[model samples]
Target chain A: MKVKLAKNYGFCFGVRRAIKLAESKPNGITLGPLIHNAKEIERLKENFNVVVNENIQEIPKDSEVIIRTHGIPKQDLELLKQKTKNITDATCPFVTKPQEICEKMSAEGYQIIIFGDEKHPEVKGVMSYCKNTPLVIEDLMALKNSKIQEKVALISQTTKNIESFLQIVDFLVRNCAECRVFNTICNATFDNQESARNLAKEVDIMIIVGGKNSSNTKQLYNISKEYCKDCYLIEDYLELRKSWFDGKKLCGVSAGASTPNWIIDKVVQDIEKL
Target chain B: MKVKLAKNYGFCFGVRRAIKLAESKPNGITLGPLIHNAKEIERLKENFNVVVNENIQEIPKDSEVIIRTHGIPKQDLELLKQKTKNITDATCPFVTKPQEICEKMSAEGYQIIIFGDEKHPEVKGVMSYCKNTPLVIEDLMALKNSKIQEKVALISQTTKNIESFLQIVDFLVRNCAECRVFNTICNATFDNQESARNLAKEVDIMIIVGGKNSSNTKQLYNISKEYCKDCYLIEDYLELRKSWFDGKKLCGVSAGASTPNWIIDKVVQDIEKL
Candidate 1:
């Protein structure tokens, strides 16, 4: 059986920059674990003395604080900067756009309606950018709690489903007299989804490659599962259970952004052996 | 021609909440336009006194501050609260999930990765929730900038395409050693998209009902367009030109969440007339 791997899959620019930054300096402390994969963290730990800083205050004074690719909150960044002059900011440019939008919408006095997962770190960071106590809701009833008005500024978390974002936007537009929406979902994000959808259509057994803790990876698993019943998630060659691919002839491989090219190669090689 | 409407069509809960809040009392002040719809905003102006407060300092103290279904950044909200005590929040619950994720990630020392349009209000709100500087990416570059090992969290701005969100997630898991993620897309959102996809398959002409400024409506238009070339977006009966009836037999109508029932009814009537 041949293994087909997605060409555009793996760690993105921001993630690369972050990893390079971590590897650039032998001495650095990560706020927590960097990325979602366990194997990668172990590798990084061997090269650099990376420690998870749970308490901001507990961080060594003037320690080289490298903001992860996902980025720390604005306040945290400010605090890091204040504490240490040496701060490496690896925040993605796309992420910064949401901050600017919140500042603009909140300043305009529009009821800031953010459509996103309330528990995700990215959502939390975007929330800090607001100028007012922006009301947030996931469903219809919760949306009702927000004061209805002619002016509502709508936005989505960068990773939100575009279709879902539109539904939320539609809801706000229908109920509110005036709704201003900015399509904040990343362009690459959308393309990745489109590609996955297209790929899923052609595959019999889909294998999503990513860390279990990775949000995007989990979403990939879920999406592939919807189309391909044999879809399953595994981190690397080690996790590839031979049992799942009993007599599987065709397997489509797709990896999360954080995934390294080396790992993708390894997975393909392992699948070929199977 | 006979017209059939979608079961889950029309103004969603968030839109209704925002509109109701705007039109509510004898005294009301919106931070900006209630929604993006021009007609609806015009209607709101007729019924209520809508005001835009762009300059944070310009807001009068003790004013009744109303939050739109589109959320604001956390910092802006704090600044607004500092100026006024009374706030009417009208936001959807699904939208708030990203905020929670940001907060949790920040507290736990994970970097926050947001997937959505960075410029959108929803993304902004999620950033604020983190109270930290987050890396917001709309594309695969986000994976490069995500958390490493022990500290990365991923989330989507609600209203995002589930397919898109999953691709980004998949990237994270494959590369990142340790990451946490949440599939925050609302249930109603998926249902709407699925319905549209299904309808597009069986209809000769599909009519999308909602405001031009509505994102979900546009998405619906895009979906229908993919399957049927004759998909039309109508804010109300006014936009439904007679050309739409060129040789259509069965027409499918789907409204956005923010579209009022009246608007859908008017469109339905117009289709019937056609």
Candidate 2:
């Protein structure tokens, strides 16, 4: 089988910066998983002695802490500050834009509507910035049941689909007296999805390499599955089956923002050998 | 023949208020046509001696001037103020909202996008309030060929259709970094269009009663024609032909914001006789 790779894939600017910041300081602890990739986190644990701690209270006093790229809630950050003065913030600039907008708009008396999964870490972080309780909707159906105020501001998760976000915006503008929209989806997500979609259209089988819990990876898998039927999402090369590649003439490979180049290279090499 | 009227039709609050204000001051020269309906303007001229003057410079010094409901340009308003202190501003509150938003958003360093006809008096009035030159687009195709800025504020004419205005909002929110949308479309336009559409769907023939130059009337006619094939737009009962009601058992009637109730009553009476 002829193997082809997407033009844009692997670690994005925010993920790379976070990884670099983590490596610079040894024996440090991250508030959460530094990035979505499990293999890279394991590598950092083994080489730099950086550990992931889910609970903020579990960390020892005066320990060096690094924030995750998705960011923590506003109150959590304040608590972390009281615990220790040494803190490294790895939150993405794109994600911070919505947080600031929410704080400002909410203070200006505009109701905030966040278009994303309420359980998602990024959405939880953004919601904490609002002065009033913000309405978080996953889709258009959720909005249909809710009563929106006269003035509302809308923001979306950084890794969400643009088409879906616009549908929510269209609904709000038609019903409300005033609507303010902030396009907070990052450029990396756009480029990665576009490249994966283009490559998937011309291939017989597609392989998406990323962590199972990664949001952008799932988005890529979903988009690729629409174009190519024989598609699989895996964390590493070991999950690939030789029989699946037997009848395929052309194979396409794509990865998410948190996916490291080494993992993608391993997957490509294993597919070639099959 | 059975004559049916729309549940919501005829003079809106703004038009009624303008007419009442004009009638209170007899012998006042209106800066422009007080409203879209020619018949109503003629009635005002004959009954109250209110004259329509299109040219601003031709008005004699210290003359009583009544502004049109759609409003004049910002510079024209300034000149009118200088020309005479005795002025009655009849500009609709719905139309004034966009003008205020344009001035505020423009001063805050945001580009303005007005979703309406460039030649329209309302749009022209709104554009003059913006500090920078604003872009006016009638449809989505016009926006496709133009380049939008990073930050944009969108406002629409009060009489525009809700669906078309929402489409422009969707497109701008998807492309721009920041978008502020003010839904300036009035409630009267929504009620009128909805009522006309509901009646047109069940009637055998539809009659849209309003002036040819009225924007809201044209919108009602377009929406009615979508559901009923035999639909006619007429200024008065005299324009209604007997052949239109030849085999039609039910006739639906709808009027624009500027249309007076007396004209609608005459049309209904004439339809019954046919």
Candidate 3:
């Protein structure tokens, strides 16, 4: 069995902690599929004996709960805390920073604005840190209509594009009288985009690594797709068809945050065999 | 009459509409500076202006309300409408469209991600359109952290930087599993930026026209400043110093969306006089 692992392959700090917490759980429900990888999620399901991230339709008093790597909205977390007897937190620390910044800004009487999807688990988790409802405006037109009194504060989710954040900040500078902004995009994401972009420039074919549902993995593919003509996003070695690699010379690989070292290694080895 | 008229004088579409509506109001309470230009604002105040953007404490219930050219937040508009018996809305139509798109997306369950600022009037206006609490994550880190579960929709403010917007969207396209984005940065804005960039290359001195407070005007300066050795943002003829024209054989003049034709003409006249 030949195999090569992605440089970024394996459980990231957050994912590893989440999986570890699940294993240590005496008894609890696993919030939403813990990670995107089906195999990993399946393994966790088998161990913790819990369901995916679903609303509590039925709950027994004092039932333990385990939060996933992607955190929950403030309301959901609060509601969960209120209803549950014990909660095991597994959200990433990097993910929590934006929320903290936003909350601090809101406390100081600044109109808090967040940049990202309003409904994303990460956005919700970040927003949860805020004291009040954040004004989530997604485009310049909405920005043209944003009603900040005197001062405004801005923040973003970690996985967001850096260029987008600067654009938004520039827009704010152009539109508003007074504004404050925080650049909280993660360093890892920057490395991924920069590396992917550089790799895309040199490679003929860019094979992105990660599950289909993984957002970060999709991002790597998208960045690579812009520069390279042939870029395919795949989950694992099993998904790679023999013919897809036909006549391919140089290939670049990238993965999502949740991917493990073993799977990345396996996919690379399989591709090497091809 | 020291009323030195600029060749590029009078209100641009946004300011014109805002001024006309405010003038139509024989009554009270101006929502914002009718225009960023102090002279124009002074004239409005002398006639029928009562400013209330970041400064006003309380507005009477029955006062006539006028919105400015830069656009106001949706919530503020709503509150004003409720407070005033007669309302005179004068927002520029060009600046209004992006807000509509953002609001619609927010209502539809898409993540409202703006490519612009959190405090900009345009962004604030757009923020108001969000059905739920929206976010304004700026930069790759913010977007990376955003990882919202639902779809993300992005739009740019009319006068934003094209390169910046695309970079952000590029990040968005990669990271987001599914996204719908609109290049809402206005046509005039693109033309202005393109024109300025192109002119910056050939001109010895690039004189940017519009108010210091004007966002687009500043962007024009930034763009021109890049290619040209001498690029100055001039508010009017009065701001033109003799030193700017000291031995300059050729000069280029460009105006912002809010800059009047008379201002550009005055600047040109000043350059000629030098």
Candidate 4:
């Protein structure tokens, strides 16, 4: 089987920036996994001596702590401020934009509507900034059913699709008397998904490598699966099945933002041997 | 045939207020017809000696000018200010609310979407307040097709139906990221339409009495027609067809904001004879 790599794959700008920040603070403890990918986090822990801990209170006082790319909720950030004097903020600026926007709009008496997965850490971080309970909608149908106020402001998580975001914007403009919309879908997620979709169209089987918990990786897999029927999401070469490559004429490879290049190369070399 | 009059009909609050204001300055020249109904305008001209002039330039300098219920464009209002020192602002406060809202929202960099007839005087007046060109959408389809902005504000002509207005509001809230809406549908129009709709449901035939040019009157006729198929819109008893009452068990009579109570009574009495 012939294998083709997606044009834009592997670590995105924000992810690279975050990993670099974590590497610089060699002895630091990240508030969460430095990134979503377990393999990448393990490498950081082993090579840079960086520890991963979810709870702020568990970390020793005055020790260096790094905020992850997904960002932390306001309460957690406040706790971190009090607990740690040596702080390394690696929160993606793209994620920071929506958080700031939600805070400003909610203060101005606008009912906030968020178009993002509610359970996602990035979405949770952004939602904490709003003064009132925001109507968190993951799909167009939920947005259609949401109760409206006289004034509303809408924003989205960094990893959401642009088309769905614009669709929600269009619906709100036609329904609300006055609306404010911000297109906060980060460029890296958009490009990666687009590249994966494009590659999937020409391949008989598609392989998307990333952590199962990574939002952008799951999105890439979902997008690729739409164009290619035989699509698989695996974290490393160990999970890859030889049966997937059987009788497949062409295969496409793509990786999520948190996926390290070394893991992708190993997966590619193993697929070539099959 | 049995004739039943709508409980709430004829001479709406805004129209009554405007007429009362015109009556106080009996000798002044109204910028336009003080109200939509021609018969009422003629009565005001003949009895109160108030003349109706469409052109601001035609009126003599320093002459008393009534602004009328529908209000005037901003430029005309400016002209009136310069040309005449004695100006009576008879513009309905309900109509004025939308105008002020459009101006304020447009100033705050919001695209204004008005749910109203584009050619309507009230809509025109509201549009004049906006610095940028406002999107005047009359129906749900037109509103759905309108291009959206990051921020949007919606207002309505005072005579628009509350149902359609709310539907538009719901659609906008679902689509726009941020939206601001003001239900500027005047109370008089809402009550009149509701009364007409209620009366039409009980009657076999309906008579809507008002000038053809009156927006609220047309709305009442449309609303009554939906519930009663044999609905007829007439200015007076002269236009009421006797054939409409043929084999009809009951007849309903309703009037618009500009329709005089005397006209409604005459139409009711004429229908009773039929």
Candidate 5:
């Protein structure tokens, strides 16, 4: 069996920068997982004594507080400022862009439309920047259910699919008299998904590596599944089955932005043995 | 021979208000023909001394200045303010709405889209209110060539056809990311077109009465011609040919908003004699 790797697989600039920041400060408490990959986060915890805590109250007063890659809400940032002087913001600049856009547009009295899953932490953080509650829609059809305002500005989360964002834009343009759109999908997410899609078509079996809870990893897995039927999303080499690769001639490997190089290399080495 | 009239025939609320305002002040020189009906304007000139002046510079200082129903630009209003102390603004409130929207939306950094003929007095007046040059497209196809902005606000001239306006709106909603649309079509135009459309199906010949230069009158004539082959647009009864009604079993008469009650009555009476 031949094992091929996607061009843009593994840790993105944002994730790498975040991990480096986390590693620089030993005994630091991250608000959440610094990066979505569990294995890399585990390595960080083992080597650097950095711990992930969902609640800020659990953090010790003297301990260094590191904001995660997804960034915290304005209210949380304010609380963090008052709680500790030792703070390292590992928040990705790509995620910070949409927050500023939402805040500026909302303050200008424009109704803000965000095209992203409301449950996602990045989307929640962006929405928190808006002074008023923005219309957060996951699907295009959901727009019909909301009361459309006369003046609107639209922005997307960093990891949102570009095609879906364009579809939403098309719908808004025809429905509203005036529409303003901002393409906020970061270069990392765009390149990763594009690379996975291109690689998926040339291979018989595809493997997507990252944390199961990671949204971007799930997106990569779904995109690969669109072109190749034998696509599996796994956290580690332990989840790999020998029987699935029995008849496959060419196998493709892709890792999410949060997934480290070590896990991807291990997965590829195991696929090569098949 | 049978003569029929559209349910909502002539002299709309705005036109009636303008005429009432014109009649209250005799010997008043209007900036333009008090309204778009030539015969009614002639009567105002002959009976009320309300002469139409193409240039405001011709008006005597301290003389009462009457602004037309299709309003003047901000610069002209200021010039008029400086020229005369006694001024009666006959600008229709419906026409004033779009101007205000253009001003406010442009001030808030939204690109304004006006759906109307660029050269038309009402559209020109509305366009003048925008701080930046607005995208004034006459048809849906014109929109395809223009660059669509993400944040937009759309308004229409009071007399634009609702169907064409909605088609333009449909295109905008699908093409723009965030669009803000305001339906600025006045009630008079809606009722007039609907009434004319209903009346045309039953008539053998259609007569659309108003000034030749009137945009709403041209729209009425166009709409009536679609349903009736023998539709004629006339400024007065002198332009009406008796031979056109020779074989017609039923005749329908509709007048534009600027057309007076007297012209419609005379046209209906002439058709009755056929």
Candidate 6:
């Protein structure tokens, strides 16, 4: 099977910036995984002595702590400020924009409507910025069931689908008296998804290379599955199966924003060997 | 042929309020046609001596002026205030909401986007409220071509199709950093259009009753034509034709927000006679 890479893939601006920031500060403790990719996290641990510590209470006082790209909650960040003097924030600017918008709009008395997964850390962080309680909805059903105020401010997760975000906007504008929407979806995510979708249409079998827990990677996988039924999502070359590529004439590869270039190259090399 | 009336049609809240206000103040000169329906305007003039004056400069000093339902330009209103103390604002609260939103949002440094015909009086009125130059787009192509700012405030004409308005909102949300959308489309307009759409599907022939210049009536006619090809837009019973009822098993009747019930009833009665 001949392998082709998606036009746009691998480390996005935010992930690349976060990695560089984390690499510069050796012996730093990240509040959470620096990025979603486990292999990259492991590499950081070995090469730069950067370790992931999920619990804020576990970190030693005055230790160098790097905030995750997803960012910590407002209260949690304040708590960390009190705990540590040496801190480096790695929160992506795309994520930070929503946080600021939520805070400002909420302060202005506009009810905030966050269109994202409630359990996602990024969403939790954005939610904390709202002075008033925000209605966090994952789907149209959740939005429909919730009671919305006349004046509303809508924000989306950076990795969410643009089509889904528009649907929420449409519903809110139709129902609410006033709706303020912040297009917080990262441009890199849109490019990756578009590339994956275009490549998936022409390929017989598709390989989505990224961390299993990565939101953008999962979205790519879901989008690719719509066009090509024979699709697989794997983290690294070791996870690739020869049986899956046996009869495939062409294979397409795509990676999430968090995915590193080296891992994608390795995956492609292994696929070629098959 | 069976003639059926749409569930919701004619004399929207704003029109009803304006008519009552105009009738109460007999011999009052309306700054412009109080409503879009010419027949209703004529009825007001004959019954209550409410005359329509298109030019603001022509009004005599200190004359009683009733503002049109569509509202007038900010400068025009200001000029009227300076000229006379006997000004009655008949501008619908729905229309007034967008004006206030545009003014407030513009004063706060957000670029305003008015989604309607540039030549429309309501749109002109809304545009005047913007402190900065507002982009008035009637279609998606215009919106795409325009150079938008980072922050935008969108308001639609009261009588525009909700679907078209939603499309503009969707595009603005995707492109702009911060988009404030005020759903200024009147509830009566929505109900009338929806009713017309529903009735159009079940009828062989659709009769849209309102003035030729009425925006909402044109929208109803356009929507009805999509489902029922045999659709006609007429001002009064005199405009109805017997040939239109030929071989039609079911006839649907709908009217614009500005259309009075009496006009709609006359059209339905004429259709029954045919």
Each candidate's DockQ score against the native complex? 0.03, 0.81, 0.03, 0.17, 0.13, 0.93
The candidate scoring highest on TM-score is 6
Over A86-166, each residue of candidate 6 has an lDDT whose tens digit, in order, gives: 999999999999999999999999999998987888999999999999999988889999999999999999998888889
- Chain B in candidate 4 has what TM-score? 0.97
lDDT of 2 by residue, B37-121 (tens): 9999999999999999999989999998999999889999999888999999999989999999999999999999998988888
Candidate 3, B1-274: lDDT as tens digits: 1112212322345666676677777555667666667655665677665555553337767776777766787768777777766776677787677777777777778777776667677777777877876667555567677656446777777678877766675565445544455666665677778888887787778788787887677778898899987888877888877786676777877887776565666667767766
Segments of candidate 4 deviating more than 4 angstroms: A1-52, A61-71, A82-98, A109-274, B3-8, B140-147, B166-177, B194-202
Best by lDDT: 2
Against the true structure, what is model 3's DockQ?
0.03
Q: Residue B18 deviation, candidate 4, in Å? A: 0.7
TM-score of every model versus the real structure: 0.51, 0.93, 0.54, 0.68, 0.65, 0.98
- Candidate 3, residue B156: lDDT: 72
Candidate that would win on DockQ: 6
Query: How many Å off is the CA of B109 in candidate 5?
Result: 6.2
lDDT values, one for every candidate:
0.71, 0.92, 0.69, 0.87, 0.86, 0.91
Q: Which digits, one per residue and each the tens of the lDDT, describe model 6 over residues B1-274?
A: 6899999998889999999999999999998899998888999989989999988789999988999999999999898998899999999999998999888998999988888887888888888988999999988889999998998888899999999999888888878888888888899999999999999999999999888888888999999999999999998998877888878898999998898988888888777877
Question: What is residue A43's positional error in candidate 5, in angstroms?
Answer: 5.7
Cα lDDT tens digits for candidate 1, B120-168: 7777778888856787877777556655443466677766666666666
Worst 10 residues of 2 chain B by lDDT: B166-175
Q: Which is the winner by DockQ between candidate 2 and candidate 5? A: 2
Q: Give the per-residue Cα lDDT of candidate 1 at A144.
A: 65
Worst 10 residues of 3 chain A by lDDT: A1-10
Considering the two chains of model 5, state its CAPRI-style docking category: incorrect
Candidate 5 structure quality by residue, lDDT tens digits, A1-274: 7999999877888898999999999989999888887888889899999989989877777679999999888999888888899999998988998899899999998799999889888888899999999999987899878888877888888887877776776567545544556667777787899999999999999999999988789889989999999999999999999998987899999998899888988989998987
